[model samples]
Structures are given as C-alpha cells and as structure tokens.
Target: MTKRNTKAKQLILNLLKAAKSALSQDILQAQLGDAVDRVTIYRVLNSFLEDGVVHKIVGDDGKQYFACCKNCSDKKYQHNHFHFRCISCGKIECLPNEVEVKLPKAYRTLNFNGVVSGYCSNC
Candidate 1:
C-alpha cells in the first residue's frame, strides 16, 4: 500500500533525517512541542517502521529509539550493522559498517539487534 505523505509524516521524517543519533519518542515530543499530538506521533512512527523509512533501536534502558534507514525496504527489512550506545551521553547511533554473523547449521537467523556500549569519540 502506498502511504500518503501527510504533514505529520513529513515532520517526523525531517526530524529523523537530521538527527545524528537515534531519537526517542520523548525527545520527539519535546522537540515538536504542541505541533503534533502523542497519539499522532505514535501512529506516524508505526507507519514509518512499516514503510521502512526508519529503523528502531532498543536501548539498554529499554527505551525505543528511531533513526533513518540506510538500506531497508518494505518487502525486506534488515539491520546488518551494530548500534553504538554512548555510555556517557546515553546516545544511540547506527554504525555504518555492516556486521556478518555466523550461525550453526540448521539454525535460521531472523532479526538482529547488536549493540555495542562505550564512550563515543566526543565523550
């Protein structure tokens, strides 16, 4: 299904595209401030996830963060790189390098969420 480009969707897309690191719903809410409602934001995010416009990252604190997808599609969604979480700033970033994981025979790999925690270069 072709998703209509709404104002809310454009706003969220711009925010995600300009973000250096993954952003949480709270951050988006604070940034948007009264421009968009919480429920609308949630729906927009869910649609973006389904459309492969963004990818979700679950932090160590159990908060969901979002970032623009570099290589994803509606048919096949996959994140082959690792997410780096800064220990000092608690910021999550999607690493550009792709990771290859080897599994035992007869085992099938599904979703991958490999996170590496450490102090970023700026920290």
Candidate 2:
C-alpha cells in the first residue's frame, strides 16, 4: 500500500474523531473548510476505507456514512456494534456495546455477514 500525505486525509480523520454521530461526505467537506477539494476529500475517504482505517455504514436515506473503527488498534472491520437510526432526526448513532457477534452453526454452512440497524431510543 502506497502511503500518501495529504491534508484532506488528516482533516477527515480529525473530524471523524471529534464527531459524535455518523458523517456523510457532504458534511465532511463542509467541516473541512477550504483545506481540500470535494473530489480530493472523497478520494481520501475511499483510500482510508480501503486501508481499513475507517468503516462505512449505509443510512436509511441510502447514503453512506463514515465512522471511526471501534477496534482500530487491531484493525478489525466487523460491524459488531448495533446502529441506531433516529427516525425523527435521521441521524445514525453508534450504540456503545462492545459485543462480538458469533454466527450460528447453520450459518457456517453458508457464508454469512451480519449487520444490525433500527430505530434508536431517541426516536
């Protein structure tokens, strides 16, 4: 993997670290001020995603939101945490549950990927 140094990546990471909720590409670009172009920010996000430095989740609006990894140290990209999508506010919140998911024996026969999302308590 080629390492590239760009302000956009740094800014994006910082924003993700600071944000409490999921962020879309538009919001990230707005928060980045004038430090990076829209295309550059998107590219940076994609690169980080490919490097396993970040994870993307799909919202109810059919838009992808990026969030920092829960197990960033180990570089695990599994969606072990449940996603809470506020029906009223349309915000995707990450619930604070450090649980690991184990698939059933039946699922082992077939390759299974798990994802959990629903209306949050705040809704």
Candidate 3:
C-alpha cells in the first residue's frame, strides 16, 4: 500500500514525524491550513498505515490517534512502549519510559498495549 512520493504525502509525513504526539485526522487537517484536501489526507494515511509508516491507537474516549512509526518495517516497536492520554485535554502521546509487565516463565511475548491516562503537563 505504498503511495508514490508526492508533495502532499511528504508534508504529512514530515508533520507527523515532527509532532510530539499522535494527532487525529481532524487536527492534522486543520494544521495543514487547507493546504491539502481531506480526501488526500485520508488516502495518504491509509497508505501509510498499510505500509507500516504509522500506527493507530484508540484512546479511552474512543477517539482514534495516529502516530508515526519509528521502525515499523519489522514491527519491533509494536510491543516496545506504552502510550499516555490526557483526560483533560484529550491529547495522546507515546510515553518515553518503557512499561514493565512481568510475565510467567516460558510465556511468549506478543502484541500488547499499555496505556497510562492522566492530565498532561498543559492540561
């Protein structure tokens, strides 16, 4: 699902990479300041998701958040870290510290999600 390199796609990728946290499509579109149409945004996002360029997460409030993948080609990041959601501001971001989950011996680790919800610094 790789998209041909285009100005719109590059813009979107750069924005996501520089973003401190995940952003909803609405927010992302708004940030674009009408530089791109909604349809193009969706197309690009869908392609990026399929290509492992980004990962989508559903927050506690049921809102979808999208963040850029660090190295999703092999998907090693799929189970590496946790996410933090700000209940007050409704912003979601990846937590810097790794979450520790103790498992029984011989238990194989697979895909998992760890979430920590609270107020962010600004909220």
Error (Å) of candidate 3 at residue 18 is 1.1
Query: Which residue ranges in model 3 land beyond 4 Å of their true spot?
Result: 75-77, 97-114
Highest lDDT scorer: 1
Per-residue alpha-carbon lDDT of model 2 for 21-114, expressed as tens digits? 8888989888877888889878888887777777787776677788877667655445556666676766776777755657776663222122
- What C-alpha lDDT, on a 0 to 100 scale, does residue 76 get in candidate 3? 49
Residue 113 in model 2: shift from native, Å?
8.6
The predicted structure with the larger TM-score, 1 or 3, is: 1
lDDT of 1 by residue, 54-95 (tens): 888888878889898875755485687889999899889988
- TM-scores, all candidates, are 0.88, 0.73, 0.76
| lDDT values for all models | 0.87, 0.72, 0.81
Q: Look at candidate 1 and tell me the lDDT of residue 74.
A: 51
Clashes of 1: 0
For candidate 3, write residues 14-104 as lDDT tens digits: 9999898898888889999789899999888888877788888777777767899874678445545788998887778987766667789
**Clash count of each predicted structure:** 0, 0, 0
Using TM-score, rank the candidates from best to worst: 1, 3, 2
Model 1 per-residue lDDT at 47: 88
